[model samples]
Target: MASGFNQKNKQCSLQELAALVPDGSSIALGGSFLHRGPFAFVRELIRQEKRGLELIKQSPGYDVDILCRAGVLRRVRAGIVAMEGNFGLAPWYRRAVERREIELEEHACASLTAGLRAAAFGVPFQPCGGLHGSSLPELNGWKCLDDPYGSGQKTWVVPAIRPDFAVIQASEVDAQGNVRVHGTAHWDRIMSRAAGSVLVVAEKVVDSAVFEAQPESTLVPYFMVQNYAVVAGGAWPGSSWPAYAIDYPAVEAYMDKNSDLRAHMAAAPEAQEGNHG
Candidate 1:
């Protein structure tokens, strides 16, 4: 079990957190496009020059694009990678897929979530009817199995996706490492439970008593969190709702300057020191 207060006192740098993730490990990122993602941590991962990471997510944005462009990823299993609204497609991700730079596994969002849910419960697989009559099963090698009980109905069985690590950004975390997600949590909760290890970046950290005062707000208990750190504005450029809104101008600037990805990355704000515990 993780020692909550002890871990809270031993906060390390973001670099140290990034270093904890080894090369070639499958990693699940939190949030949808431009919403509550750990963008700063993704930047640190790139800064550390990590490589051969396998990324898993529902819908990704700049976080995954940066990693893909940095040549840090070996494969990506995602439902989609659009920029949401009028932002259209994520340019770098689209280019990477077009160029075949990284292997891609496209699964339906429901199937992907189901797989993670199964993993969280320590199940081998989850049966779903969502992929029926779709090419995804054949494309991703999902098995179509028949129901054993009298009914001859078939279901697509999505294998569990237990990642090596899950990195999530939260609205708040108590000293005991209980996380609170203010808005739509996306897949963070399930991914945290499904991964072998979990790391969280929070906009604020308060006393454990705060959670005790409002227990329903605690989305992830301390036992599920292996490590956590308070990183104000940690999501930067991506919105961490109820705390900060999306940096639209910054995103626009990024889109305009995206052709020089390395240069833009080099100019990104430095991550804070105390980012891991």
Candidate 2:
């Protein structure tokens, strides 16, 4: 149904799309630290100045960083930042956390994955051993206790995170929003199913028959997607495959030139390199 509906029938614009999410809605974003990720839509959300939106990111990117900087996000339940390779070492995100600009509930990647998976599985919560001996205990409001068997072990049981909405990008999706992903799919599958609502952006729109040809390859079914958009260069300035190239020089320029997300969001989209023709 997501594909059957057009821009007029569905919420397509970023402002209108953001309006669908009320204050205090928990959101899930799809992607790892980098590579193929969603950033354009995320930027638009921040531009609309959406408030009280809690975020759940399995592998956050500059998308998370911008939201935090714009002060639109109130709380974050994330595995790590898209930076630093280890978890999250984003310069802007780290600075905001250090300054107490936002509320944070940090967890390890495995635990974050389990949390979303639990939601997708329709479970209340999953028992996780992440953050056994780290500052996450005090920050996340989670109870970290010791073992009674004298095993000298510690564990932190993180509650499941079922999001109000999930936003993600895909290589290709049928008109009905049945998406297919290959090669380092990332947590896109879990995040899409775990949310009460799902919005997918695809580069190309194909017929449902294509998706049906390889049912197993369909990571997300149409029923789960409430809205879908065919957006080219949707993952701009970072990663887009086959269709376009990642504009890293522009991303770095945006990062260096703008101090706040507001300014960066207001700036023009980066012009692609080697377009002399």
Q: Which candidate is the best by TM-score?
A: 1
Error of 2 at 84 (Å): 5.0
Task: Score every model by TM-score.
Answer: 0.92, 0.81
- Residue-level error in angstroms, candidate 2, position 172: 1.3
lDDT of 2: 0.69
* TM accuracy, model 1: 0.92
How badly does each model clash, as a count of residue pairs? 0, 3
Q: Which portions of model 1 miss their true places by more than 4 Å?
A: 1-10, 257-259, 266-277
Task: Spell out the clash pairs found in candidate 2.
Answer: 3-175, 33-82, 81-88
Give the C-alpha miss distance for residue 149 in model 2, angstroms: 14
Writing each residue's lDDT as its tens digit, candidate 1 over 1-277 gives 2334564343455667788899899999998899999888898888888998999999988888878778888899998787778577777777788899989999888888989988999999998776767999999888888889969988889999999999988888877678888878898888998999988888877777778888877778887777776667778787889888888877776777335766666544443344333
lDDT score at residue 140, model 2, on the 0-100 scale:
68
